[model samples]
Target: MGYSRDAWGFDEYHPVAQNGSNLYGKDGIGFMIVDSLDVLIIMGLDEEYKTAREWVANVLDFNQNSYVSLFETTIRVLGGLLSAYHLSGEDHMYLTKATDLADRLLGAFNQSESVFPIKFVNLNSTSRRNYDGSCLADIGTLQLEFKYLSHLTGDPKYWNYVEKIMLRIDELEKFDGLARNYVSVSRATFSGALIGLGALGDSYYEYLLKQYLLTNKTEQMYLRMYNEAITGVKKHLLKRTNSSHLFYLGEFYYYNGGKKTRFVPRMEHLTCFAGALFALGSEKIHDSFSEENLIIGKKLTHTCCEMYFTQATGLAPEYVLYNTNSTGDTLYDNGRKHNVLRPETVESLFLLWRVTGDIQYRQVEFLYLLTFKEWGWRIFQSFENYSRFPEGGYTEIVDVDAIPPKRTDNMPTFWLAETLKYLYLLFEDPDNDLLSLDKYVFNTEAHPLPIFVPSEEIRGEGWNRQ
Candidate 1:
């Protein structure tokens, strides 16, 4: 409500600055407002939703000249708008805006000889790559939104556009079914030897299983690819702490472009998404491996919680590096140290709680004995203690381990869209009509999209031609 009144159309709400910024601006897209609009609706903040909806209906426009990230814009704004549309009583205005945005975004695809999407969109409808290569996640995560819009609008072009990209990737050569993080769009091939389920690579796999689930589990192609990817992950990247034997998926530079693996000991906080991935997708992995995947999901989730506890502030850093050979102090905080109030860990806890029927994954207590069961609650308390502003809204911290954690100016929109949304749903009763996992598949940004049985047009032809 405060941000809606104070900085209604900015990319983020800055607490210390007492202002807003269009940091990811494509000519004031109201990045935060658009990204978090569904949050307001889902949380039952009617007054706030009204104000935000007014800004969206009247002020939001996608026809600016500036270039925007294809992945970020799709996941945040397009995904948010679509989720809001479905949740807001099938609001036609939201669908109109979402359609307009998607039409423009379609320009980002097929700029190359390949169907791979480029990283940037010139909102005025100019085609540009902005960069030479796209990451696995960026190209791989766009399916649900596009396909759903196709379902909604009876437009097979969108279904084919995104589906062709997936089919192209499906046909590409991969290392034991694992994809390298980058692709040369012009070359139509993988360009790098690195593989990890973190920032550049996390949600691609998350969506594979989800795409299957998203369409009432009829997409055998998505399921087949997802299973192969998981099998490759276990074969090549799965690792353990030296002493505690905790499971962590480590990165790998595949033998200087060959399949024989060498491990990178770093674990990105972004990589914690694998926890939820494993939890949610485990049962769907192949019959013999299903329970094994579930157990691995639980242990991988515990490793993420352990990362938070290793920090002085009880919040995880951006990443933690492990010294696999070290008999002592296996965890090291290196590179990025800020806690931007990311929701990946609790996102895992929420899904784990839902999938496994475990209260311990959320909030629960035992007599005088504190345990990892308190992770979500402790994380919430830490957010208030460190980042919450005196006036309104919370900011990112420079270092979660800092005593009296130093606050940064910007608070990411995902803090609203993903972090708080997951936290709220973690405690909400699952039987409620709103967002049951069986009914909705959340995009990487945590915007929930309804799962529908795909119509014939969505499964229509010509996309499989690539």
Candidate 2:
């Protein structure tokens, strides 16, 4: 609980009462704080925003030699900076800082032998850590931030690097337009045949739709690929619970040589984003398939809400496995019964409420608040049993099904960046127009970036009739 400069360390899990310094040195807390900067602006906390901005500008340093996750740094630090920069009236300092961070991150994509970027990089050295293969999310989620940076800075390299990833993905052999979860960057070959709208593959589909919107629907390739992916999803991943008839997405591995397909009746909190994303895309396209997409989105949202209602603590688990043969609603234990306070469901709830004007969607806010209160109180009471600790922040739920739900010693950055932020947006008046879907699209991490009108010179290649 003692101090170490201005940085805070990870929550101690084994001891449960002790905290340690940052593994990456003194700026870890600053990086975490930057993730919440947009939340301050969203809540209209001017003084807090100013203070945080000052701290970031003065205290945060990216010159360290620590190795960091490419995906994490881009989405949180770069995405956070870009969102804050746009929201704060295009402050030059934010843009400069964001570009600086992004330039260093560009090292990840510098591999000449591979079509995709490496998984991690050292900020100080511009050296990359190669992984065996990259997931769909890692390959495809960079378009929003990088494209936005290109549009702002007029640097084609940022956009061109990320656009290459999209084009490479389009060339991959897919089963009905569904890409495998992991792809070898150097070989440009898929490692597995499994597919889902969850972790590894979630944002690949996400960026397809978002890239279209970000480019003012001028790019037909994005829309065509997204529609094809949706078709593949409906054909392969769509499933319904036996009792509730609740529609959810599941994962499956397809074997070569006509072998039997293996299906897994599981869903993750991360998959909930598809509901809102689909609904949002429907509103824009307005084609024959739009209504079907909207319907699927609504059903998916309801099923995600049910994940919370079925749990004892009114909180959804990190993942759930369904009983495929049960006549009644039954969830199988997959040894992942804990909730990490993820925001995907609530984020979709907020977006669907905006899209449909449904009071029911807005009403989900009460469940979120109730769950947070119940969990917060229990954790606070448990803290008394441990040694005296610092104030503020909440931890994950070890078991949502527990009577007095057990608590994990970790708190994730998304709890503030996405969970509470989306909940806050849900309660805002409709007239505020803070995050109008027509004007901005959110990155996978829930950071909002303005949708830009495509330049006359901007034209995407590799287009064909659908």
Candidate 3:
């Protein structure tokens, strides 16, 4: 029997304060609140519906900042609000806030030259010493935001801004059709041959293709670009190990190779790339996306399953070894402060399950459930050094050593929203569908329920169904 909505109360699942039991315990109630909203949206959890609403209210209070960073303040927070509104169908005010942020963020765009500067204004001085800071992923992130804005408001300016950014990407593609890992918007040229598709690159390609597909527009140039990007990833970035599984190379061109080169399958980038490919391939289940597409998806999915997923732990590694087609190492990247066991991987597993309904994914999730029970939840690093209660029940952890000894307090909502969304969808009927891209959500208070868009109605000439 299915877990009934009313039986799924969240109070017991709620994190405790300072007793040190799990990551999401008292110190991480914020994440739990967001996760609760995700659960309600996907699974319609009747038990904590009221609590979920209250949780969002709390997040708004905690996240309030006088001067927020672009990625942190604008993209992430706005993304969280949009997601919350989609689930709760309330908080129309969030739309205004998101738009206001978007307006400020747009000023960061170099419309005169059709590109966006990496930093609207660097709040951190680390990069101020040099004019060499850029993030390729933000281009894709901002595009998605603007696309959503246009869809929700029924205005073309939002998408127009995104298109202008696309024009910049088009210019960058001329160098063998590979987008540089970083570029100077002012110079309008690539800095190096370095490239990647897992995080920044993957989403960049996704926006290009998905935008075309969703808008009923297709161009040969886009097809060529997408093909090259995917193919390049397969050649230089992807590798099949002797373990009969595949993993992407951490450093494609080594943005800063040699001594300064850091190459590892960052959990964030890997999961995002894999999830996008899986979802994209699934969306084209009935279309002709080439045998290679399906095979690539299947192979990549299997590889990701093997590389990061440990059925024993149900927790995917933050980084995995991937150097050959025969065998690769499974060493964790513990040196970096950002490398940590994340809840997002679990969410990716849920997404894979939604796409393929594969029993393997469920079994994998079962492992994750066990891992959490055993390892316990440790929330964010505190203000004081690494001093923290390892046994805390916080929902999100900023770093693996988030004890009071290592002290760093930062919480982002993507994990909360994505993880809960995955869990909710996991429990809900697989037959249920998602909302149409054409119809956008307007508020956080409440939004229309996701409606399934029939795959059959979507037709493409010369696209194969088999």
Candidate 4:
């Protein structure tokens, strides 16, 4: 029902082999849809969650061998359902589905190595280690999910395991206190010389520092690491091209002086990272006594809005070339593949709107609503008609213009959770920033904090320390 052949025009090549079982490429598209739910709910959009939850429950199952990427599916769906449970108090049928998925995910945790891969493809098989389990780049994202799991199950292990993973990732990222995309755990070498904050890397840093503050462990090292990552993001990932701030795809440093290349930032990458930073910064306001930290949060929120959103459409490109002057770069002019108006970017916009009473945020959301009503409806109709993303979520590696007329299986659910949650909070309060704070949100790792307020309160009432 989620991605049916009728919803898409699937015929011979990309046939609907198993009738929603193995519809897309190894259930990768399934993961995306699940991720989308997470993002929507977080944004405060309840309807999206209901739709996505129903979609996941009826469409996907973990029993199939083809659904190995279900590890992420486990976290998102379970995490989302738990959030739903939190919202409704009365359990939904979907919560059972989530609990079942959680049991499967716990089984997938490798006690021997203490590492979770991108997914649970094979248990005893080593062949699934494509990036040597480095595929867990954004695995830090599970921070909130893990915390939620611990809260529900009354087991600290879920939160503890995620924290260990964060510390492990922190050690890996500690070269000059900035995180790199790829790391060879076996060889202890950072291979993916490309440095930039795609969703995964960027979110990890946000959680790391934010988690430390939540746990009352915001030491100098934590601050240093967090600041450095932000500095690196601002310095390397951001670029100004003809009055537009473009986030590059990825950067490859030719330390040996070979051809240097940087990819433009994809829509997926920017939307997720921007939201993560906003979430981390928004937590500062809850501290109440820390005006300095609150200011930092305000700045981060402001930057995210400035860099990503536009008046034309809340929707953004799949990717933008960092250096617009260069024509031959792969990062330039990548269009939209999956034409679906991803709800995740809208979630980021809502988060800022909720924090500051900016009427412009509503304008942005209105633009998105208009876009969906106009062009995006076709994408949803196609998704309902067929199974693909109308084209695909990617557009020529970095381009978003080329809509292949089919959606993929990689929807970011955090977008759903974040967006819906923010919207819900906005309607619920519309004023107090206090109510919007995530009580036990994830830090960079899976560490569950009682609260994520600032470490020290800065009383700037009368002036300087001197």
Kindly report which residue pairs in candidate 1 clash with one another.
none
Candidate 1 yields a Cα-based lDDT of 0.80
Regions more than 4 Å wrong, model 4: 1-67, 90-100, 111-119, 122-133, 173-175, 185-189, 209-224, 242-272, 275-315, 324-331, 334-340, 359-435, 438-466
In angstroms, the error of model 1 at 377 is 0.7
Candidate 1, superposed: residue stretches over 4 Å from native = 24-26, 127-130, 256-260, 283-286, 359-373, 431-433, 460-466
Q: Estimate each model's TM-score.
A: 0.93, 0.88, 0.64, 0.60
Candidate 2 per-residue lDDT, tens place, 1-466, comes to 1212223433112223434344354446245567877998999988878877887787777777777767778887899999999999998888988988888888787743576888777777855555667788887888889888988887778887888888888887788888888878777667777788898999889888999998778778888899899898988899888776778989979779226577898888899888888788788888898888877887787777778767667677778887788677557574788877777777776776777775432232123233322332333333233212245345676677776766675556676688878777876788988889889988877889998964433333523323
* Model 1 Cα RMSD, 1 decimal: 3.1
Candidate 4 residue-wise lDDT, 1-466, digit = tens? 2333222212112222322232334543344454344345445568756766676667656553432443344444555556555544535554565556665555445422445434444422333434444533445556556554555555666665555555566566343455555655444335565555554455556555554454444334555556666555555544434333323324434233234545453334343445435445545534442343333333333333332333122334444434455443224343432233343444444444544444432222123223212222332333343333334321111222333333343333333234334434434445444334445543232212245223123211111111
Q: Comparing 2 and 3 by TM-score, which wins?
A: 2
User: TM-score rank, highest first?
Assistant: 1, 2, 3, 4
Best by TM-score: 1
Worst 10 residues of 1 by lDDT: 361-370
**Candidate 4 weakest ten by summed lDDT:** 457-466
Clashing residue pairs in all predictions, respectively, total: 0, 0, 53, 76
The lDDT of model 2 is 0.74
All models: lDDT?
0.80, 0.74, 0.43, 0.43
Number of the candidate with higher TM-score, 1 or 4: 1
Q: What TM-score would you give candidate 4 relative to the actual structure?
A: 0.60
Q: Each model's RMSD to truth, in Å?
A: 3.1, 4.8, 9.6, 9.2
lDDT of 3 by residue, 167-228 (tens): 66665543335576676656655566456665445456554554444433333444555666
What is the Cα-based lDDT of residue 243 in candidate 3?
A: 53
Q: What is the model-wide C-alpha lDDT for candidate 3?
A: 0.43
